[model samples]
Target: MINEIQHTAETKMQKSLDVLRDNLAKVRTGRAHTGLLDQVEVEYYGSMVSVSQVASITLLDARTIGVKPFESKMAAVIEKAIRNSNLGLNPAAMGDLIRVPMPMLTEERRKDLIKVVRGEVEDGRVVVRNVRRDANNDLKRLLKDKEISEDEARRGEEGIQKLTDKYIAEIDKMLATKEADLMAI
Candidate 1:
């Protein structure tokens, strides 16, 4: 039972790390990547769909993202969607391809992004700590119910703490990398 609790707690911690990774990916730097437009939605037929569904996104260069729509007519709609999205991108249509260039980040913008990254790191840490708390609570409950020995509960809590520390270290590493990316010219 103690092993089961540790395994579940570790799994939850890993998932929290993944969520932090996806959230960090959304915080773009000056460099261009296909993930930047992952959230842009366009009207396809009668339903709204992601830009990636109706168009193929590629990195044209370090600073430019190339989006090619499958159908020629969808170029206009895709361009409009990218423009209207809150990514602060400007997509210019040159024939069938839409060129979305990533603007250079100013000092103020970089600082703002750093602040956002810090907030995300803090949130990640909180989630990991919460998982630890839940696991410890479960351990206590098991001990009180006479299901797990006191020593087993103590060991389980220690294991959960170690997992929390490991995940928090990973989160801190991610923050450092992101901060460096943001600060880069």
Candidate 2:
């Protein structure tokens, strides 16, 4: 049972790290990436579908995103979706393709993005800590129920703390990378 609790905590902690990675990916770093539009959904035939479904998004250059709808008629729809996605992006309709240019980040904007990244990292830290707390609680419960000896409970708690430290370090590494990316000109 202690092993089970440890496994669950590790799984939850890994999930938190994955969330941090995905959130960081969506944060703009003055580069054009297809992941930037992964959250955008376009209206296609009365159904809300991802931009990738209705269009092929590619990076035309370091700062330009190229989106080509499968159907020429869907170009306007895809462009409109990008405009309304609240991502602060403007897509220009160029014949059958839509070009979304990633604007350069101002110094102030870069600072602001850094704060956002920091907040995400903090949240990731919280998630890992919470997992640790839950695992510790499970150990306590097992001890209370007399299902595990006091020594076993102590070892289990130590194991959980080790897992917490490992995951928190992972989050810190990811945050450092993201901060460097945001601060880079």
Candidate 3:
């Protein structure tokens, strides 16, 4: 029973880390990346769909992304979707492909992005801490039910706390690296 609780808590903590990594990928740095637009949804045939589903996106250069829709008619719709996105990119239509050029970030804009990244890191830390709290509660319940001895429960609690510290430290390191990348000229 003690092992089961520890395994479940570890899995939950790993999931929290995965969420943080995904959120970081969507945040733009100083260069162009296709993953930045992976979440963009475009209107297709009266329905909204992810851009990746309708087109093949590629990074053409350090500041440009090329999107080619599988169907010719979806070109206009794809361009419209990018234009309306919060990314502030303008798509230039060429035949059946759309080219988006990433603009250089000004000092003020970079600072704003850094703030957003920091918020995401803090949210991740909260998730990990919540998981730790839940695990601690479960350990106490096990002790109350006499399912585990007092010594075992204490050791389990210590293990959970150590895991929480390790994951939180990992998040901090990732945030520092991303901040440096954003601040780099």
Candidate 4:
């Protein structure tokens, strides 16, 4: 039972880390990355679809993303989707291809992004801590029900704490890397 609780807690912590990773991927850093457009959805045949579905996104250079629509007619739609994606990007349709250049981050913008990153990091920490709290509560409940001994509950709580600390450190590391990327010129 204690092992089961630990396993569930560890799994939840890992999921929290993954959420932080996905969030960081969306925070662009004046560099061209295909993941930046991962959230863009384009209208296709009366249905909305991911931009990557109707087109191919590639890095044209360090600062430019090149998107080539599979169908020539989709070029205009793809351009419009990117322009309205709220990513502050402008896509120029060059025949069948749409070129999206990553704009340089101004100092104020970088600081703002840093603040966003910090908020994400705090949220990640909270998720991990919440998982730890749940696990601890479960341990206490088990002890109350005579399903676990006092020593067993103590051990389970310790294991949950360790998992929380490990994942929180991972989240902090991700935030540091993202901040570095944003601060880079």
TM-score of each: 0.98, 0.95, 0.95, 0.97
Q: What's the lDDT for candidate 3?
A: 0.91
- The lDDT, on a scale of 0 to 1, for candidate 1 is 0.94
In candidate 4, what are the lDDT values of residues 4-55, reduced to their tens digit?
A: 9999999989998998899888888999999999999999999999999998
Q: How should the candidates be ordered by lDDT, best one leading? A: 1, 4, 2, 3
The best candidate by lDDT is 1
Q: So what's the TM-score on candidate 4? A: 0.97
lDDT per model vs. reference: 0.94, 0.91, 0.91, 0.92
Per-residue error for 161 in candidate 3, Å, reads 1.1
What's model 1's lDDT at 152? 88
**Could you give candidate 1's per-residue lDDT for residues 128-159 as a string of tens digits?**
99999999999999999999898888988898
> In candidate 1, residue 158 scores what lDDT?
90
Q: Specify the highest-TM-score model's number.
A: 1
- Candidate 2 structure, TM-score to reference: 0.95
**Candidate 4 Cα deviation (angstroms), residue 184:** 0.7
With candidate 4 superimposed using the best TM-score fit, by how many Å does residue 14's alpha carbon deviate from the native? Answer: 0.4
Predicted structure 4: lDDT: 0.92
Name the candidate, 1 or 4, with the larger TM-score value. Answer: 1
Instruction: Extract clashing residue pairs from model 4.
Output: none
